[model samples]
Target: MSSSPTEVSGGGVFQDVHIFSQNVNCNYAHVDYVLENLKDSVDVLFFQEPPWRTIRQTVSIALVESDIVMGAPRYPDWLYMVRPPTDECNPCVIAYVHRCLAHLCPSMQWDIIDHWDIFVLSLFTPKGAVNFLNIYSDNAHTAINLLSQEVNMLPAFIYMGGDFNCHSKVWDPAHTLYPLVAQHLLEFASDVRLEWAHSSNPGLTHTLHNPDLASSVIDLVFMGPLSMLSDLPRLDLNCCGPLDHVPISTLVPISEFEIRISRMVILRKSPEESGFLIDITTGLWALNVEDLFSPDTIEVATSAVAEVFSLAWNAHAKEVVITACSKS
Candidate 1:
């Protein structure tokens, strides 16, 4: 994360938000594909069966790198700043953010709900706020009963995408709809006004079953306010990779912004933090003890000392909204 150009101590402020969804089946081999083809290319990418194992542990915020960051049950030796025990894990999901967008990541505010079969993220953006889930449900529809209950609780910007495994003639011509799942998904979609995106999907989104070739349109993406979806995503079943399930992609229509850069406003700190700054200044002054210094040189040294503290404080400062702006 880089520093801002301007500074305004106590103010709230205002920003490509692209989203891609895929089920990599926990295949580390495909990490390269994500870094090379997606990375910062997409703002929020929901993944199913991500490489990391989901655990009942999460953090309020985390600084992520090129690797995927997950809510852990504690990765044991995994580098972590904070790891709060989460509700569940199992069906792990990782949100891979690009370095450029690191400064504006949702980690600071968004709630990452980890479940064996789903990863729900509630995020606020310039347009509005949204709660999207990356889910993986098996044929038994184990979570179907709780699915609606869980989703019904979301506040706004509702959307769901991932591996539903709901066999249906609607998306796959070769298969018949599972009565139970069809009922669950159809009703849910109707309730949310989420138009499923694979009306014309040629069949499989999962193909690596090998011998029997159990290919079907299990991977799904559903969204509301159709305008958000600029184009229908197609499954790249012919992906030249080692992964089993295909990665779905499409152009999401998000209003771009002209980010106005500014420097940080330095404010007085708490007594404790201020004590450290005073200690630093005292230590520096001690080095030149007994030297007859000019008042101008002393002023310069003082400014330099203040600059160090200012930079440190601004680095961890919270983002505040200064005003609202229009969106496309």
Candidate 2:
């Protein structure tokens, strides 16, 4: 399923969104393997820790051939990629929005803070536990301090997802780190309101040297709000190649279905809350009812409505509805 970026064009801009993250070295064969697997599903990709020259070539290849978009590093750490024909354009952060969303894309400017030998992709502004701050934090307390300082400067909604290089007990008290990097992460997430996304996954990332204890979840996806993650499925495909650790992939959908599910849960918890009702109303208004009945519409709406009822329906309301329907 390999596709060059040049092969995409449509009546409406591509709306189905996909993201891929890989750490391809100079081995063009590995790059080819990754592109083959991703060409069909992903419109945007984020490759971390690749050689600077290789990243440049990948971007050039994507730009010339595929309708896909690529974000190569201008400096050292971060690169944002996207598929084309969309209107959103940010030089610092690559954005590939559907042409339909071109009007909604905001023109925001990003200022480079610092660059390191190891590439880092900053996911979000710091809030609390769910905020993701991707960095290669060494097993030193000083590294934790540096991360803390950086996270403190971001907004609350930021989600940090990527390699942190530190999985000490301090972050995962159940597990232990030699110097307590885990604790640092815990404190960092607590201060900002970010929670680890794949906390439930049992697999560890660093596999080569520590194969016996190779099940540490070092690479992470942190979220500012748990509500932001409607579904968190881990991709454990055996595509690590020569690398010890396999790549991790997660799905994040900014769809009405996801929004409705979150809204319904809130409404069910506090049915009397004005804010909950208002949110439900707003979500319903934003939803395309016509699409709900369309043959082409996926089952997303049905599940979304069911989830809302599951969260919001009171025992009395459920009984009443059942009785009314039976009588009718």
Candidate 3:
């Protein structure tokens, strides 16, 4: 569950962004397990067929006796991003962003495509916002069709993946004839400047209980222009919890920034605090405010007061770096 930088053969280091994608198959326990156990190992998670259930019941003001507060499971370290569900339909796709990426201001792009079966997660970087699409195309290929129509409107997505429920020779060599819808799927991905990102450990991503039926690689991942530097996605055979579809993960390299771990503070009731207060009073009294009549003079006097306080605080305060082992 570590995110340490990996050393390359050429003595270079890669700060990789680990992304995990899976089809939860409407299981809340699976979602809970992933968020709780995989938070440290994964930076972002894209889930399909996510469970949506009532978390609690509340007193209602309308005709109904009570209203149910329904939502997906929430965790402190992960930002759950999903489309708003209606009475007729719940979201089939959801994306979880770890808190480490909070500073990047990750957001869901509902304006681009407002379908319940699809969601677009955007992470703002120095270059611009990088988008990742989570999808769950059913037997009818609803999400895939929507993607085809909205291909021109999509931003360059670094990654797009989920339970595509599609089988073709393009990804699965077992299939003899290419389905027309599969062709549409490939065309849409290509139109958005995306190419198939083959899994490093290639195998059947989907499994069946009946021994007679053959399993296939329905779950898939695609990469866009922005993800050219990313490592190939891999299927985790061990992580799938009682699900037919295996989880796909990838490491994407991104620019890193140092996190500030310390701040200057004047402890209360300490000698430094007393000195800071005394200095602040003395500096305030020394301010030469001749007139309160003019707006410019008032502005100048206010700025001077702020400067006096800041200088006193800086002079008296001590900087401390807080760590996990530090006590209150």
Candidate 4:
């Protein structure tokens, strides 16, 4: 919230850092609630399975008051990076840094399948210069591949976070897959050569939609030489709704950059109130309720409702009003 670095103990050197992750189920109410509570404490917000509406509509509505918005291709079984809107939507994930920290914005690139979206934000300070790498990885195997690629491409200072989706089993710790993942992680840490940068809380960052299943620490925050873990904020498992995963937040120390541009776009009218009113009218007329109850149709209806919220009206609120009107 302060947009200033909090000092952290260092083995070598340290940078300020703050990161949080959530699998927000594209529900406006829930997303709004989380952001309201977390906006002040976190610098960057990462999400998975965000509502599938267009970026212009969803980001504007959800993060309208935030500093920036960015999004990437939807990864099937992994995480996606998105933020409030900036000047416009781009290929890399959307980001919103504090207005004072705009100078940190850097060039970004994405890999095939959009599994990994990386952006380098340069930090200038009296101590030295540092760069933060914002990353969102797929599951375990994909995490190994992505991290390996980054090890070669990344510069010295880096802080990577998102859904890494990897679990540790002490038994076969020497196995190739687990060992390979561990080695790659170690390689990155060694490159930075800071003993205190790594913050691992096993089983604390688990994300699962079903309340019954045990949660695993799949979400992570990995720092390089320039930063040290100052504090591990309480993990929010209760925020996990129908979605099968929880959200995680962390705080680190690094230089702050000045954000040059920030913007928020909103969709106020319902589709009916807008020019494309007939799209909704025709879709409703075509619906047979009896035959339109399949999962596919439900998905379509859900999307349509989201569209209404973006273009025409607040779909969820409208539904409640309509039900009340009918009862009256």
Candidate 4 ranges beyond 4 A from true positions? 1-17, 25-30, 55-94, 103-116, 126-128, 170-179, 192-202, 211-214, 225-229, 232-243, 255-328
Score every model by TM-score. 0.56, 0.47, 0.71, 0.50
Q: How accurate is candidate 1 locally (lDDT)?
A: 0.50
On lDDT, the candidate that comes out on top is: 3
| Candidate 1 C-alpha lDDT tens digits along 1-328 | 1022111124323222355567777676575465555442455566666665433443445544343445422222111212232554444455543344343434512333334666655344554444455667776775454565443333333456777877777777886433445555755564444567763345577776587766677787776555244456656554426766777654433233212212222224746456556665665665533433886556455545555544544454333322111110
lDDT of 4 by residue, 1-328 (tens): 2233333346433345465656554554555565555444555555544443443433355565644423433322222334433354332233334332334432233321233244444445544455545544455455456655544333444455555555544212222233335444544544433232333333455545477876565555565333443454445565565555556655656643222211111124744345445545655566545556676766566545544433432232222111100111
lDDT of 2 by residue, 109-216 (tens): 222223231222222111111112234343454435665555434333234455566655533445632333454565566544557765435465556555465455
Which candidate number maximizes TM-score? Answer: 3
Model 1, TM vs. native: 0.56
Which whole-number lDDT from 0 to 100 does residue 101 have in model 1? 39
Candidate 4 yields a Cα-based lDDT of 0.44
**Against the unseen true structure, what C-alpha lDDT does each candidate score?**
0.50, 0.40, 0.77, 0.44
RMSD of candidates 1 onward, in order: 24.8, 18.7, 21.7, 21.1
